[model samples]
Target: MPDRVLVAYGTKNGSTAQIAEAVAEVLRKDGLDAEALPAGSVTAVEPYDAVVVGGGLYAGRWHKDARRFVRRHRRSLAGRPLWFFSSGPLDASASERDIPPVPGVRRAMTELDVIGHATFGGRLEEGAKGRMARMIVRSGRGGDFRDFTAVQAWADRVGQELTAAGRR
Candidate 1:
Protein backbone atom coordinates (compact mmCIF):
# COMPACT_ATOMS: atom_id res chain seq x y z
CA MET A 1 0.00 0.00 0.00
CA PRO A 2 1.14 3.55 -0.69
CA ASP A 3 1.87 5.78 2.25
CA ARG A 4 -0.25 8.76 1.28
CA VAL A 5 -2.49 10.05 4.03
CA LEU A 6 -5.05 12.82 4.25
CA VAL A 7 -5.50 14.87 7.38
CA ALA A 8 -8.86 16.56 7.01
CA TYR A 9 -10.19 18.99 9.58
CA GLY A 10 -13.26 21.11 10.29
CA THR A 11 -12.27 24.13 12.27
CA LYS A 12 -14.24 27.29 12.99
CA ASN A 13 -11.34 29.33 14.37
CA GLY A 14 -8.50 27.56 12.47
CA SER A 15 -7.03 25.93 15.54
CA THR A 16 -8.05 22.49 14.37
CA ALA A 17 -6.47 23.24 11.00
CA GLN A 18 -3.24 24.02 12.79
CA ILE A 19 -3.50 20.72 14.62
CA ALA A 20 -4.11 18.92 11.34
CA GLU A 21 -1.01 20.54 9.91
CA ALA A 22 1.00 19.44 12.89
CA VAL A 23 -0.24 15.88 12.48
CA ALA A 24 0.66 15.96 8.79
CA GLU A 25 4.13 17.27 9.54
CA VAL A 26 4.75 14.50 12.00
CA LEU A 27 3.50 11.87 9.57
CA ARG A 28 5.71 13.32 6.88
CA LYS A 29 8.66 13.15 9.20
CA ASP A 30 7.91 9.47 9.63
CA GLY A 31 8.14 9.13 5.82
CA LEU A 32 4.45 9.09 5.05
CA ASP A 33 3.20 11.37 2.28
CA ALA A 34 0.63 13.38 4.16
CA GLU A 35 -1.24 16.62 3.61
CA ALA A 36 -3.63 18.53 5.77
CA LEU A 37 -6.82 19.82 4.13
CA PRO A 38 -10.05 21.47 5.13
CA ALA A 39 -12.87 18.92 5.26
CA GLY A 40 -15.25 21.26 3.43
CA SER A 41 -12.79 21.81 0.60
CA VAL A 42 -12.15 18.14 0.05
CA THR A 43 -14.47 16.55 -2.48
CA ALA A 44 -12.90 13.12 -2.44
CA VAL A 45 -10.92 10.78 -0.18
CA GLU A 46 -10.36 8.16 -2.85
CA PRO A 47 -6.83 9.31 -3.60
CA TYR A 48 -5.48 8.81 -0.12
CA ASP A 49 -4.16 5.60 1.34
CA ALA A 50 -5.63 6.41 4.71
CA VAL A 51 -7.62 9.25 6.24
CA VAL A 52 -7.61 11.11 9.54
CA VAL A 53 -10.68 13.24 10.07
CA GLY A 54 -10.94 15.77 12.85
CA GLY A 55 -12.98 18.70 14.08
CA GLY A 56 -13.72 20.96 16.98
CA LEU A 57 -15.99 19.61 19.72
CA TYR A 58 -18.52 22.41 19.90
CA ALA A 59 -21.94 22.36 21.59
CA GLY A 60 -21.75 18.56 21.98
CA ARG A 61 -21.14 18.16 18.25
CA TRP A 62 -18.43 18.09 15.68
CA HIS A 63 -17.97 21.01 13.32
CA LYS A 64 -20.35 20.85 10.38
CA ASP A 65 -17.68 20.33 7.76
CA ALA A 66 -16.35 17.16 9.35
CA ARG A 67 -19.81 15.71 9.77
CA ARG A 68 -20.70 16.57 6.21
CA PHE A 69 -17.49 15.05 4.92
CA VAL A 70 -18.24 11.80 6.69
CA ARG A 71 -21.79 11.80 5.40
CA ARG A 72 -20.61 12.31 1.84
CA HIS A 73 -17.76 9.80 1.95
CA ARG A 74 -19.20 7.12 4.16
CA ARG A 75 -18.88 4.36 1.61
CA SER A 76 -15.34 5.19 0.57
CA LEU A 77 -14.25 5.50 4.18
CA ALA A 78 -15.66 2.13 5.17
CA GLY A 79 -13.23 0.38 2.87
CA ARG A 80 -10.06 1.97 4.20
CA PRO A 81 -8.09 2.74 7.31
CA LEU A 82 -9.67 5.73 9.01
CA TRP A 83 -9.01 7.69 12.18
CA PHE A 84 -10.99 10.34 14.02
CA PHE A 85 -10.13 13.11 16.39
CA SER A 86 -11.93 15.84 18.28
CA SER A 87 -10.25 18.98 19.49
CA GLY A 88 -11.38 21.84 21.69
CA PRO A 89 -11.53 21.26 25.39
CA LEU A 90 -10.53 24.36 27.32
CA ASP A 91 -9.71 22.33 30.35
CA ALA A 92 -6.05 21.96 31.27
CA SER A 93 -6.10 18.20 31.48
CA ALA A 94 -5.58 16.46 28.19
CA SER A 95 -6.99 13.41 29.93
CA GLU A 96 -10.17 15.27 30.68
CA ARG A 97 -10.41 16.16 27.00
CA ASP A 98 -11.39 12.58 26.18
CA ILE A 99 -15.04 13.35 25.77
CA PRO A 100 -17.31 10.88 23.97
CA PRO A 101 -18.01 11.40 20.29
CA VAL A 102 -21.04 13.36 19.24
CA PRO A 103 -23.86 11.54 17.50
CA GLY A 104 -22.63 12.31 14.00
CA VAL A 105 -19.06 11.34 14.77
CA ARG A 106 -20.14 8.21 16.57
CA ARG A 107 -22.12 7.17 13.54
CA ALA A 108 -19.18 7.76 11.26
CA MET A 109 -16.88 5.81 13.56
CA THR A 110 -19.31 2.94 13.70
CA GLU A 111 -19.80 2.82 9.95
CA LEU A 112 -16.16 3.30 9.00
CA ASP A 113 -14.80 0.88 11.62
CA VAL A 114 -12.15 3.41 12.51
CA ILE A 115 -8.70 2.30 13.58
CA GLY A 116 -8.61 4.72 16.47
CA HIS A 117 -9.98 7.96 17.87
CA ALA A 118 -8.42 10.69 19.99
CA THR A 119 -9.30 13.95 21.64
CA PHE A 120 -6.76 16.70 22.03
CA GLY A 121 -6.83 19.74 24.23
CA GLY A 122 -8.19 22.91 22.63
CA ARG A 123 -7.26 26.57 22.53
CA LEU A 124 -9.55 29.39 23.58
CA GLU A 125 -8.03 32.83 23.61
CA GLU A 126 -9.59 36.14 24.38
CA GLY A 127 -11.16 37.73 21.25
CA ALA A 128 -10.86 34.49 19.32
CA LYS A 129 -14.53 33.69 19.87
CA GLY A 130 -17.83 35.51 19.50
CA ARG A 131 -19.53 37.33 22.36
CA MET A 132 -21.20 34.27 23.81
CA ALA A 133 -18.25 32.05 22.98
CA ARG A 134 -15.87 34.50 24.54
CA MET A 135 -18.06 34.69 27.59
CA ILE A 136 -18.02 30.91 27.80
CA VAL A 137 -14.25 30.89 27.56
CA ARG A 138 -14.01 33.60 30.17
CA SER A 139 -16.03 31.49 32.53
CA GLY A 140 -13.47 28.67 32.27
CA ARG A 141 -9.71 28.25 32.28
CA GLY A 142 -8.94 30.10 29.07
CA GLY A 143 -5.62 29.12 27.55
CA ASP A 144 -3.87 27.22 24.78
CA PHE A 145 -4.17 23.64 25.99
CA ARG A 146 -2.93 21.99 22.81
CA ASP A 147 -0.19 19.46 23.50
CA PHE A 148 2.05 19.35 20.43
CA THR A 149 4.36 16.68 21.76
CA ALA A 150 1.51 14.29 22.24
CA VAL A 151 0.15 15.19 18.85
CA GLN A 152 3.46 14.39 17.22
CA ALA A 153 3.78 11.19 19.17
CA TRP A 154 0.34 10.08 18.09
CA ALA A 155 1.10 10.84 14.45
CA ASP A 156 4.38 9.02 14.62
CA ARG A 157 2.69 6.00 16.08
CA VAL A 158 -0.02 6.07 13.46
CA GLY A 159 2.49 6.47 10.67
CA GLN A 160 4.54 3.57 11.91
CA GLU A 161 1.50 1.40 12.26
CA LEU A 162 0.34 2.31 8.79
CA THR A 163 3.68 1.44 7.32
CA ALA A 164 3.80 -1.83 9.19
CA ALA A 165 0.29 -2.75 8.13
CA GLY A 166 1.12 -1.97 4.51
CA ARG A 167 3.88 -4.55 4.64
CA ARG A 168 1.35 -7.20 5.59
Candidate 2:
Protein backbone atom coordinates (compact mmCIF):
# COMPACT_ATOMS: atom_id res chain seq x y z
CA MET A 1 0.00 0.00 0.00
CA PRO A 2 1.13 3.56 -0.56
CA ASP A 3 2.24 5.49 2.47
CA ARG A 4 -0.53 7.30 4.25
CA VAL A 5 0.08 10.93 5.01
CA LEU A 6 -1.95 13.34 7.03
CA VAL A 7 -2.12 17.03 6.24
CA ALA A 8 -3.70 18.81 9.15
CA TYR A 9 -4.27 22.48 9.81
CA GLY A 10 -5.87 25.08 12.05
CA THR A 11 -7.46 28.25 10.77
CA LYS A 12 -9.92 30.92 11.82
CA ASN A 13 -11.08 32.20 8.44
CA GLY A 14 -10.52 28.86 6.60
CA SER A 15 -7.47 29.95 4.55
CA THR A 16 -4.96 27.61 6.13
CA ALA A 17 -7.35 24.72 5.61
CA GLN A 18 -7.33 25.46 1.88
CA ILE A 19 -3.56 25.35 1.82
CA ALA A 20 -3.58 22.04 3.64
CA GLU A 21 -6.06 20.63 1.16
CA ALA A 22 -3.87 21.69 -1.73
CA VAL A 23 -0.89 19.99 -0.22
CA ALA A 24 -2.85 16.80 0.31
CA GLU A 25 -4.10 16.89 -3.25
CA VAL A 26 -0.59 17.11 -4.65
CA LEU A 27 0.55 14.25 -2.48
CA ARG A 28 -2.37 12.13 -3.71
CA LYS A 29 -1.52 12.96 -7.30
CA ASP A 30 2.02 11.86 -6.55
CA GLY A 31 0.70 8.38 -5.75
CA LEU A 32 0.43 8.61 -2.00
CA ASP A 33 -2.58 8.26 0.24
CA ALA A 34 -3.09 11.63 1.86
CA GLU A 35 -5.87 13.46 3.63
CA ALA A 36 -6.31 16.97 4.95
CA LEU A 37 -8.06 17.45 8.25
CA PRO A 38 -8.46 20.03 10.95
CA ALA A 39 -5.86 19.79 13.68
CA GLY A 40 -8.40 19.92 16.48
CA SER A 41 -10.47 17.14 14.96
CA VAL A 42 -7.65 14.67 14.74
CA THR A 43 -7.25 12.47 17.77
CA ALA A 44 -4.10 10.64 16.80
CA VAL A 45 -1.27 10.48 14.26
CA GLU A 46 -0.19 6.91 14.92
CA PRO A 47 -1.85 5.57 11.78
CA TYR A 48 -0.01 7.72 9.27
CA ASP A 49 3.43 7.18 7.81
CA ALA A 50 3.98 10.92 7.45
CA VAL A 51 2.31 14.10 8.63
CA VAL A 52 2.04 17.77 7.70
CA VAL A 53 0.73 20.29 10.18
CA GLY A 54 -0.18 23.89 9.51
CA GLY A 55 -1.83 26.84 11.18
CA GLY A 56 -2.85 30.39 10.62
CA LEU A 57 -0.78 33.13 12.27
CA TYR A 58 -2.27 35.63 14.64
CA ALA A 59 -0.26 37.92 16.90
CA GLY A 60 2.96 36.14 16.04
CA ARG A 61 1.57 32.83 17.27
CA TRP A 62 0.08 29.76 15.70
CA HIS A 63 -3.56 29.11 16.19
CA LYS A 64 -4.22 27.51 19.59
CA ASP A 65 -5.51 24.29 18.05
CA ALA A 66 -2.31 23.74 16.08
CA ARG A 67 -0.17 24.39 19.15
CA ARG A 68 -2.18 21.99 21.25
CA PHE A 69 -2.19 19.34 18.54
CA VAL A 70 1.59 19.32 18.37
CA ARG A 71 1.98 19.18 22.10
CA ARG A 72 -0.49 16.36 22.31
CA HIS A 73 1.10 14.28 19.55
CA ARG A 74 4.75 15.14 19.96
CA ARG A 75 5.83 11.61 20.78
CA SER A 76 4.21 9.92 17.78
CA LEU A 77 5.25 12.82 15.57
CA ALA A 78 8.84 12.42 16.63
CA GLY A 79 8.89 8.92 15.25
CA ARG A 80 7.53 9.87 11.83
CA PRO A 81 8.51 12.15 8.97
CA LEU A 82 6.92 15.49 9.71
CA TRP A 83 6.48 18.89 8.08
CA PHE A 84 4.89 22.18 9.10
CA PHE A 85 3.55 25.29 7.45
CA SER A 86 2.22 28.68 8.46
CA SER A 87 -0.16 30.87 6.48
CA GLY A 88 -0.58 34.44 7.62
CA PRO A 89 1.34 37.04 5.70
CA LEU A 90 -1.12 39.48 4.17
CA ASP A 91 1.10 40.47 1.25
CA ALA A 92 3.18 39.18 -1.64
CA SER A 93 6.23 38.61 0.51
CA ALA A 94 5.72 34.86 0.81
CA SER A 95 5.77 34.40 -2.96
CA GLU A 96 8.66 36.83 -3.45
CA ARG A 97 10.93 35.27 -0.82
CA ASP A 98 11.13 32.47 1.69
CA ILE A 99 9.62 33.38 5.02
CA PRO A 100 11.01 31.47 7.96
CA PRO A 101 8.72 29.84 10.43
CA VAL A 102 7.74 31.89 13.45
CA PRO A 103 9.65 31.51 16.74
CA GLY A 104 7.08 29.16 18.24
CA VAL A 105 7.00 26.95 15.16
CA ARG A 106 10.78 27.01 14.95
CA ARG A 107 10.98 25.73 18.50
CA ALA A 108 8.59 22.90 17.69
CA MET A 109 10.57 22.09 14.56
CA THR A 110 13.70 21.77 16.64
CA GLU A 111 11.96 19.73 19.28
CA LEU A 112 10.28 17.36 16.84
CA ASP A 113 13.01 17.43 14.21
CA VAL A 114 10.62 18.40 11.43
CA ILE A 115 11.82 17.83 7.88
CA GLY A 116 10.61 21.12 6.35
CA HIS A 117 8.34 24.14 6.65
CA ALA A 118 6.87 26.85 4.46
CA THR A 119 5.10 30.14 5.00
CA PHE A 120 2.36 31.02 2.54
CA GLY A 121 0.45 34.26 2.17
CA GLY A 122 -2.93 34.47 3.91
CA ARG A 123 -6.50 35.34 2.97
CA LEU A 124 -8.95 37.58 4.73
CA GLU A 125 -12.14 38.76 3.09
CA GLU A 126 -15.66 39.78 3.90
CA GLY A 127 -17.44 37.43 6.36
CA ALA A 128 -14.20 36.50 8.11
CA LYS A 129 -14.69 35.78 11.77
CA GLY A 130 -13.83 38.13 14.64
CA ARG A 131 -13.93 41.87 15.11
CA MET A 132 -10.32 42.44 14.15
CA ALA A 133 -10.87 40.51 10.90
CA ARG A 134 -13.88 42.60 10.02
CA MET A 135 -12.00 45.75 10.90
CA ILE A 136 -9.11 44.79 8.63
CA VAL A 137 -11.44 44.14 5.71
CA ARG A 138 -13.22 47.44 6.32
CA SER A 139 -9.85 49.18 6.36
CA GLY A 140 -9.08 47.73 2.92
CA ARG A 141 -6.09 45.74 4.10
CA GLY A 142 -7.68 42.33 3.83
CA GLY A 143 -7.20 40.25 0.70
CA ASP A 144 -6.10 36.85 -0.49
CA PHE A 145 -2.34 36.83 -0.81
CA ARG A 146 -2.05 33.06 -1.06
CA ASP A 147 -0.06 31.82 -4.04
CA PHE A 148 -1.27 28.35 -5.04
CA THR A 149 1.65 27.89 -7.43
CA ALA A 150 4.16 28.22 -4.64
CA VAL A 151 2.01 25.98 -2.50
CA GLN A 152 1.95 23.26 -5.17
CA ALA A 153 5.69 23.43 -5.74
CA TRP A 154 6.38 22.98 -2.06
CA ALA A 155 4.02 20.01 -1.82
CA ASP A 156 5.60 18.44 -4.87
CA ARG A 157 9.00 18.64 -3.25
CA VAL A 158 7.59 17.11 -0.12
CA GLY A 159 6.01 14.31 -2.14
CA GLN A 160 9.33 13.61 -3.82
CA GLU A 161 11.03 13.34 -0.46
CA LEU A 162 8.42 11.00 0.93
CA THR A 163 8.37 8.85 -2.19
CA ALA A 164 12.16 8.59 -2.15
CA ALA A 165 12.22 7.75 1.50
CA GLY A 166 9.63 5.06 1.05
CA ARG A 167 11.70 3.43 -1.64
CA ARG A 168 14.70 3.06 0.60
Candidate 3:
Protein backbone atom coordinates (compact mmCIF):
# COMPACT_ATOMS: atom_id res chain seq x y z
CA MET A 1 0.00 0.00 0.00
CA PRO A 2 1.08 3.55 -0.61
CA ASP A 3 2.05 5.57 2.42
CA ARG A 4 -0.92 7.46 3.79
CA VAL A 5 -1.02 11.24 3.98
CA LEU A 6 -3.76 13.14 5.77
CA VAL A 7 -4.83 16.54 4.52
CA ALA A 8 -6.86 18.32 7.15
CA TYR A 9 -8.39 21.73 6.66
CA GLY A 10 -10.65 24.37 8.21
CA THR A 11 -12.68 26.47 5.84
CA LYS A 12 -15.31 29.13 6.24
CA ASN A 13 -16.75 29.41 2.73
CA GLY A 14 -15.26 26.13 1.52
CA SER A 15 -12.35 27.63 -0.36
CA THR A 16 -9.70 26.14 1.84
CA ALA A 17 -11.46 22.80 1.79
CA GLN A 18 -11.40 22.82 -1.97
CA ILE A 19 -7.73 23.63 -1.91
CA ALA A 20 -7.10 20.72 0.40
CA GLU A 21 -8.96 18.41 -1.94
CA ALA A 22 -6.87 19.60 -4.82
CA VAL A 23 -3.71 18.97 -2.92
CA ALA A 24 -4.88 15.50 -2.03
CA GLU A 25 -5.66 14.81 -5.65
CA VAL A 26 -2.18 15.84 -6.68
CA LEU A 27 -0.61 13.60 -4.09
CA ARG A 28 -2.77 10.67 -5.10
CA LYS A 29 -1.89 11.27 -8.72
CA ASP A 30 1.73 10.85 -7.72
CA GLY A 31 0.85 7.39 -6.29
CA LEU A 32 0.59 8.41 -2.66
CA ASP A 33 -2.45 7.47 -0.62
CA ALA A 34 -4.07 10.71 0.54
CA GLU A 35 -7.35 11.90 1.92
CA ALA A 36 -8.85 15.32 2.56
CA LEU A 37 -10.72 15.74 5.82
CA PRO A 38 -12.07 18.53 7.96
CA ALA A 39 -9.97 19.51 10.91
CA GLY A 40 -12.86 19.13 13.36
CA SER A 41 -13.46 15.62 12.12
CA VAL A 42 -9.97 14.44 12.80
CA THR A 43 -10.02 12.77 16.19
CA ALA A 44 -6.62 11.09 16.02
CA VAL A 45 -3.42 11.27 14.04
CA GLU A 46 -2.43 7.64 14.33
CA PRO A 47 -3.60 6.46 10.90
CA TYR A 48 -1.35 8.59 8.77
CA ASP A 49 2.38 8.67 8.27
CA ALA A 50 2.44 12.32 7.19
CA VAL A 51 0.03 15.24 7.61
CA VAL A 52 -0.86 18.45 5.86
CA VAL A 53 -3.00 21.01 7.63
CA GLY A 54 -4.66 23.92 5.90
CA GLY A 55 -6.93 26.75 6.99
CA GLY A 56 -8.58 29.86 5.70
CA LEU A 57 -7.34 33.20 6.97
CA TYR A 58 -9.88 35.50 8.50
CA ALA A 59 -8.80 38.95 9.60
CA GLY A 60 -5.23 37.76 9.42
CA ARG A 61 -5.89 34.65 11.48
CA TRP A 62 -6.17 30.96 10.83
CA HIS A 63 -9.39 29.23 11.86
CA LYS A 64 -9.43 28.21 15.51
CA ASP A 65 -10.10 24.53 14.90
CA ALA A 66 -7.02 24.17 12.74
CA ARG A 67 -4.91 25.64 15.47
CA ARG A 68 -6.52 23.41 18.07
CA PHE A 69 -5.86 20.26 16.05
CA VAL A 70 -2.15 20.95 15.94
CA ARG A 71 -2.04 21.85 19.62
CA ARG A 72 -4.03 18.84 20.77
CA HIS A 73 -1.95 16.40 18.77
CA ARG A 74 1.43 18.05 18.85
CA ARG A 75 3.23 15.03 20.18
CA SER A 76 1.93 12.68 17.52
CA LEU A 77 2.48 15.31 14.88
CA ALA A 78 6.05 15.96 15.99
CA GLY A 79 6.93 12.36 15.26
CA ARG A 80 5.82 12.58 11.63
CA PRO A 81 6.52 14.79 8.62
CA LEU A 82 4.22 17.79 8.87
CA TRP A 83 3.29 20.48 6.37
CA PHE A 84 1.04 23.53 6.63
CA PHE A 85 -0.74 25.77 4.16
CA SER A 86 -3.10 28.73 4.45
CA SER A 87 -5.59 30.25 2.07
CA GLY A 88 -5.19 34.00 2.44
CA PRO A 89 -4.22 37.22 0.68
CA LEU A 90 -7.20 37.36 -1.65
CA ASP A 91 -6.60 40.77 -3.08
CA ALA A 92 -5.21 41.18 -6.57
CA SER A 93 -2.27 43.07 -5.18
CA ALA A 94 -1.60 40.46 -2.54
CA SER A 95 1.93 39.15 -2.77
CA GLU A 96 4.24 37.22 -0.52
CA ARG A 97 5.73 40.47 0.75
CA ASP A 98 2.26 41.79 1.57
CA ILE A 99 1.10 38.75 3.49
CA PRO A 100 2.96 38.22 6.72
CA PRO A 101 2.47 35.26 8.99
CA VAL A 102 -0.77 35.20 10.92
CA PRO A 103 -0.33 35.20 14.67
CA GLY A 104 -1.94 31.82 15.29
CA VAL A 105 0.01 30.26 12.43
CA ARG A 106 3.30 31.65 13.65
CA ARG A 107 2.69 30.29 17.11
CA ALA A 108 1.68 26.87 15.83
CA MET A 109 4.69 26.70 13.52
CA THR A 110 7.06 27.09 16.45
CA GLU A 111 5.33 24.43 18.49
CA LEU A 112 4.83 21.96 15.66
CA ASP A 113 8.18 22.38 13.94
CA VAL A 114 6.33 22.27 10.61
CA ILE A 115 8.60 21.27 7.76
CA GLY A 116 6.85 23.33 5.05
CA HIS A 117 4.35 26.18 4.93
CA ALA A 118 2.59 27.94 2.07
CA THR A 119 0.18 30.82 1.60
CA PHE A 120 -2.39 30.42 -1.17
CA GLY A 121 -4.94 33.00 -2.20
CA GLY A 122 -8.58 32.51 -1.25
CA ARG A 123 -11.98 33.24 -2.81
CA LEU A 124 -15.03 35.14 -1.61
CA GLU A 125 -18.34 34.96 -3.39
CA GLU A 126 -21.11 37.54 -3.41
CA GLY A 127 -23.88 36.93 -0.85
CA ALA A 128 -21.86 34.12 0.61
CA LYS A 129 -20.21 35.85 3.51
CA GLY A 130 -21.40 37.31 6.79
CA ARG A 131 -21.79 41.06 7.16
CA MET A 132 -18.26 41.54 8.37
CA ALA A 133 -16.80 39.14 5.83
CA ARG A 134 -18.86 40.76 3.09
CA MET A 135 -17.54 44.13 4.06
CA ILE A 136 -14.05 42.78 3.93
CA VAL A 137 -14.72 41.29 0.53
CA ARG A 138 -16.49 44.33 -0.81
CA SER A 139 -13.82 46.75 0.22
CA GLY A 140 -11.90 45.58 -2.85
CA ARG A 141 -9.93 43.62 -0.34
CA GLY A 142 -10.64 40.09 -1.53
CA GLY A 143 -10.76 38.08 -4.71
CA ASP A 144 -10.09 34.57 -5.93
CA PHE A 145 -6.36 35.02 -5.71
CA ARG A 146 -5.46 31.34 -5.82
CA ASP A 147 -2.61 30.48 -8.12
CA PHE A 148 -3.18 26.85 -9.03
CA THR A 149 0.26 26.53 -10.56
CA ALA A 150 1.96 27.45 -7.32
CA VAL A 151 -0.26 25.12 -5.30
CA GLN A 152 0.40 22.20 -7.62
CA ALA A 153 4.11 22.88 -7.56
CA TRP A 154 4.12 22.76 -3.80
CA ALA A 155 2.24 19.48 -3.86
CA ASP A 156 4.86 18.09 -6.19
CA ARG A 157 7.56 19.04 -3.74
CA VAL A 158 5.64 17.43 -0.91
CA GLY A 159 5.36 14.27 -3.01
CA GLN A 160 9.10 14.22 -3.46
CA GLU A 161 9.63 14.69 0.26
CA LEU A 162 7.24 11.88 1.05
CA THR A 163 8.98 9.63 -1.43
CA ALA A 164 12.33 10.37 0.14
CA ALA A 165 11.04 9.79 3.64
CA GLY A 166 9.52 6.45 2.68
CA ARG A 167 12.87 5.25 1.43
CA ARG A 168 14.46 6.10 4.75
Over the stretch 29-93, how does candidate 2's per-residue lDDT look in tens digits?
99999999999999999999999999999989999989999999999999999999999999899
Task: Evaluate residue 77 in candidate 1 and report its C-alpha lDDT on the 0 to 100 scale.
Answer: 86
lDDT preference between candidates 1 and 3, better one: 1
| Inter-residue clash pairs, candidate 3 | none
Better of 2 and 3 by TM-score: 2
Candidate 1 — which residues are off by over 4 angstroms? 96-98
Writing each residue's lDDT as its tens digit, candidate 1 over 1-168 gives: 558899999998888999999999998988889999999999898999899999998887898999898889988888888999888888756654456776778877887899888788888887775675788767866678898877888888888889888789
**Number of clashes recorded per candidate:** 0, 0, 0
CA lDDT of each prediction against the hidden true structure:
0.85, 0.95, 0.84
* lDDT string, candidate 3, 1-168, tens digits: 338999999888888999899999999988899999999899999999999999998887888778788888899998888899998676643345445467778787777788888888888877656797788767866567887777888898998889877777
Best-performing candidate as measured by lDDT: 2
- Look at candidate 1 and tell me the lDDT of residue 128: 73
Look at candidate 1 and give me any clashing residue pairs: none
TM-score for predicted model 2 compared with the true structure: 0.98
Ranking by TM-score: 2, 1, 3
- Among all windows of 10 consecutive residues in model 2, the one with the lowest summed lDDT is 1-10
Candidates arranged by lDDT, highest first: 2, 1, 3
Candidate 3 lDDT score at position 135: 89
